[model samples]
Target: MDSHKILSLLGLALRGNHLAVGEEPVEAAARAKDARLLLLASDAADNTRRRTVHFSEAGQCLWLRLPFTKAELGRAVGRTSAALVAVTDIGLANAVANRLAQLDEDQYGEAAERLALKAKRAAERQSELRAHEKNVRTGKYRPKPRRTPEDSSPQVEKSPPDRRPRNQNRSRPRRGSPTRSPHPYAHSRPVKKGKGSFRKRED
Candidate 1:
């Protein structure tokens, strides 16, 4: 039998607080229906074995006799001696039973298979719960309003900007420059006849 693996799992369960050692605690867990599996040491007393059966019935869970003695089981759970142990978590129960079934399929096969299915379903439920919580935290639980084609506003085509030459648009020159008349003769002064006139006036 793979005794080391079973003991290791027990130690893990103990560390996680999923295991209840001793008669009183096991019986309490069984009565509360929190025990997933009950483990009985191979060297347990007849009376202890009988009570384990009763506890299993009360908890509606499976009970298995481990190949390890009370001392070995006890050390696995950090106790001086332990004859009975109640596993509260389904996953741990499944792991321990699966390792046992690998050692002796004829004895632990059915329980392992049942616990495996239960653990799988429990894991799926936990995953779905986490996803739901994430959606709630990120505000994705509410449906967003979608805009349809009919609800969209019409697009207006914009006219292109003027690209014509800028000089063609200027009709006047800049300020501070001399002005020219339309005809040179229009603004010419008449020649005066008083002094040294070179030009004569017609009558």
Candidate 2:
């Protein structure tokens, strides 16, 4: 159950085309009936682990968490990096699982416990907020009303139109059109000398 042996078996599985590497392939393999086991890296992202676990459980496949980092697992199978790998061959799956079980305690249990604790705290916070909302609705808690600046200021009552501007010289700039005086030549008809209004007098 040495780590080296486990890695060698994974490489063999990959070479024989019985291994599914990377996220999508692992998820697909887990969902397929032929998949026998899913191997997840210890440092695999929370989201990746969650997805693979969900799919594996749904497909009723076994999932084993390895102690290696993504790079180590990927390198074992000639990959750049990998979060998951699925074994499609039953014999290889059992061998890998048994090997893993022999050497170490549950490598994944601590992470799972942390996730569960976080979920519990979040649920408790949400429940408290819901209870507070229910109390507000039932009139058990009354929040104080906030006062705005306008509410606090006094009204001036608009003093008597400013007393007609004291001396009337500047009285609202005169509202109506003022009367226009007549033109100087308004009394006389236009001279009828010609249709043209003005012409030189005959000599």
Candidate 3:
């Protein structure tokens, strides 16, 4: 089908059901899984192209690679760098499928074949990525063994002990008793002298 016809059909389909449009191929691919048809530009990136093709093949959805420029594709779908567009309706679904089938029989056959090949390659790449991710998650990719507490203990030399007593004078004074004097005069009282009573009568 012509690009204008495809665009009109897509608009009708979008009007009939909820449609999700994306500027990136990955988002478009995700939406395409539940969509009746997916639309992409001819100038999409290798990754985007592969993803779009994969979405179409894996989901059994009709796909169209428009010959318009990125800007034109964006204008057609009302976004910039629009790599993917989804149409979700039974009527539009059947129309897009029929249109794409007719295009595949005509001038678009070579492009469709190339998309199929790219989709196959993308599928293989996805499988490899998943395998690598699983290995990493399961710790199969790591080679070094983890360290344990036994591997980190330190070795120390033994030392000899001293024999000296801890306290030389261990006796403790009673709570109410007088403390022992350190000198002879520490507790002594002063002596006093007085004259006899007969000496006082002379005054």
Candidate 4:
């Protein structure tokens, strides 16, 4: 039994809804004869281990110690520490138990465990939020100040933009003598009708 294969199968059992976690649930499953196999964490409390063992024996089901500690088991199951987990499906239970018997660690189980932990974190976060809210109600909560994006990132101070007009940099054209025009009729006077001033001579 490869440890990874066992853990992977357990993870699959959990995902497939073929497994149960926690003492009460496992006990209930065992009592109902729904549980086919039981997995106890190596570091489970003595009382919990004893109780689970008793239930397993009474239910005529086989119980095995997992390679992982209680914390690791709980992490895999999306809980703080799952002392015992039961497989409800006969096929999966058999497969998991057989794999556990072959027991060497592998990489596949790590992915399963990581994925299980990620799935459980959302619920844990919500629980934490609720706890924080309760603390607030009791006036025992001190929320950490939020870090603004501006505060977290480096800020460069820039000089304020010049408020003067855009053309201020260019000198005003001096108002002096009028510039000569390039047109041929630059000095031509206004034309008058029935008069000879700057017009055709009287015929």
- Any runs in candidate 2 off by more than 4 Å, and if so which? 105-203
Poorest 10 consecutive residues by lDDT, candidate 2: 108-117
Superposition TM-score, candidate 2 onto the true structure:
0.51
lDDT of 4 by residue, 1-203 (tens): 36556677878889999889988889899999887778888888889889988988877777777779988787777788888999887667656654654453362344234434544674688889999899999999888899999899999999999999868865455578565567979789877766664666598
TM-score of every candidate relative to the true structure = 0.66, 0.51, 0.41, 0.49
Query: Candidate 2, residues 1-203: lDDT per residue as tens digits?
Result: 38999999999999899998887777777666767778889898889878887978876776777889999998999989988988887667766765666675475444334434544675698899999999999999999899899888996787665655466856454669674446767777876655784676999
Question: In model 4, what are the clashing residue pairs, if there are any?
Answer: 1-99, 1-102, 1-103
Per-residue lDDT of 66 in model 1: 92
Identify the leading candidate in terms of lDDT: 1
lDDT of 3 at 16: 60
TM-score winner between candidates 1 and 3: 1
lDDT per residue (tens digit) for residues 1-203 in model 1? 47898999999999999999999999999999999999999999999999999999998999999989999999999989999999999999999999999998999999999999989999999999999999989998976799998569797788999898899776576688777677879967786657664567789
| Each prediction's RMSD to truth | 16.7, 14.0, 13.7, 16.7
| Most TM-score-accurate candidate | 1
- Using lDDT as the measure, what is the rank order of every candidate, best first? 1, 2, 4, 3
Worst 10 residues of 3 by lDDT: 23-32
Tell me the number of clashing residue pairs for each predicted model: 0, 0, 0, 3
> Which regions of candidate 1 fall more than 4 Å away from where they truly are?
142-203
Candidate 1 Cα deviation (angstroms), residue 50: 1.9
